[model samples]
Target: MASSEQHYILPRPEFDKPTKVLIVISPYYKAIADDLLSGARAELDAAGASHETVEVPGALEIPAAISIAYRQSNFDGFVALGCVVRGETTHYETVCNDSSRAITLLGLEGASIGNGILTVENLLQAEVRANPDKQNKGAGAAAAALHLIALSRKWGRSGREIGFQPEGIQIAGKAEGPTTA
Candidate 1:
């Protein structure tokens, strides 16, 4: 068994500009979800970031909800919170893996998401990890999203523009060919 050790807790990052974050949570396990939301909200508050919360049916819906908000809303980042306790059937594995993979894919696509879905063996484990005083994974996830947002702001537009003349950049919908300088 992996030792449950508290290694280090990073301080909440500071933002130069005001930031808004969306928190998407699955309240299937009502008590656990509430605890997770509390931790995440506390972290966002401490960092001086404003946030809005939305509830879904289960862990699998977290990534989907975040994706929708990412496209439709102006939020700077997102925090996904949920608890998945392992069951006897293979459904446990499916939920855990699919939710995690979707969250990762969204993050890769510049969604700036922090995944707080807990994959544990039992309810006790979930409670311990979700507890604000204990592992507090929800807060950790919020911090991760905040860090990514700060990094994104620090280094804007990575200079990877494509389909343009090196010198004479083509204007959109002006002409079929590149505009002359």
Candidate 2:
């Protein structure tokens, strides 16, 4: 048999600045919650992101705390990290929908909210997202926040004309001198 080939993928662009981030984590699943925090920290350290973490009682409390964090100061971005596994009742839907809607509203209002909340049917899937080496939802959230931070900076510095495209894939504006964000 022939030898198998290996492939490696690299992360996208990094924000080159003292990115200030606020991470709101719900302690519903304390054990797995620790992994999300650790993964977030690892990503932040690797990317030189300045971040602060706040603990919430449960997933339902995450959005409220996030709202408070948003009103506190001019943080570059926000990360909402929580885990809501399906229970006997319909509580999961409420938490997931409400929290996600809150974050979406914040983003639409020009406040970037990196959503890393895990809505899983079981603990196994939640563990997958909490895995530091595999999915690492926290790291993914950090990356998103960093991206939004960079875009916000670019907008502020470049007169707010060059904003993210409709799909947020690329920024649209006059092609001129590139400014450091």
Candidate 3:
């Protein structure tokens, strides 16, 4: 039923300069991960964006990896890929919620992240979503990251200063030479 509904896809964003992206994947499900990676790679290629891939142990680690890369590397954006099939226990909920939350937190902290981690009812659902020929959620996620990167570039004030002013710099609206009172 949902598959029958059409969804609008935005055009891939254009960049004035070359963009670099990092794909952090949790290869817990090899086949699904491979398909997701393929889709992501294809989308990045179409946008003329450069990217590199890294593997983590599980879905929970995907966010951590992305956070580390965001701080230590110069990537313009990030794509997070993984499959979390619901299991008999509650572990599924934890993984899905925690990982999603962490990724959101990273985004709030100025990291351009596309969350492609699939939390599905079963393996079949994961497979369908990850398939490049089918849902291709990976491509959707990559598109999101690219859009975010574009927005950051558009609104970013690189020349402006943030945080505390350097030593000896006067605060704005304050007396420049001497106290009036």
**TM-score of each candidate structure, all chains considered together:** 0.86, 0.78, 0.89
Model 3 poorest 10 in a row by lDDT: 171-180
Best by lDDT: 3
Q: Is 2 or 3 the stronger prediction by TM-score?
A: 3
* TM value for model 3: 0.89
For every model shown, the clashing-pair count is 0, 0, 0
Model 1 lDDT per residue over 74-116, tens place = 9999999999999889999999999999999998888888889
Tell me how far the alpha carbon of residue 88 in candidate 3 is from the true structure, in angstroms, after superposition. 0.8
Q: Give the TM-score of candidate 1.
A: 0.86
Angstrom error at residue 127, model 2: 0.7
Please, what are the lDDT tens digits per residue for candidate 2 over residues 1-181?
1113333434644776577889989868886788888888887788787888889888778778878778878687888888999999988899889888988888887877778898988998888778787678888887777778777777775444544444433335545554568
lDDT of each: 0.89, 0.79, 0.93
Q: lDDT at 30 for candidate 3?
A: 98
The ten-residue window of minimal lDDT in model 1 covers 168-177
Residue-level lDDT for 135 in candidate 1: 82
Give one digit per residue, the lDDT tens place, for model 3 in 1-181: 5556789999889988999999999999999999999999999999999999999999999999999999889999999999999999999999999999999999999999999999999898888889999999999999999999999999997656566655556655453344456
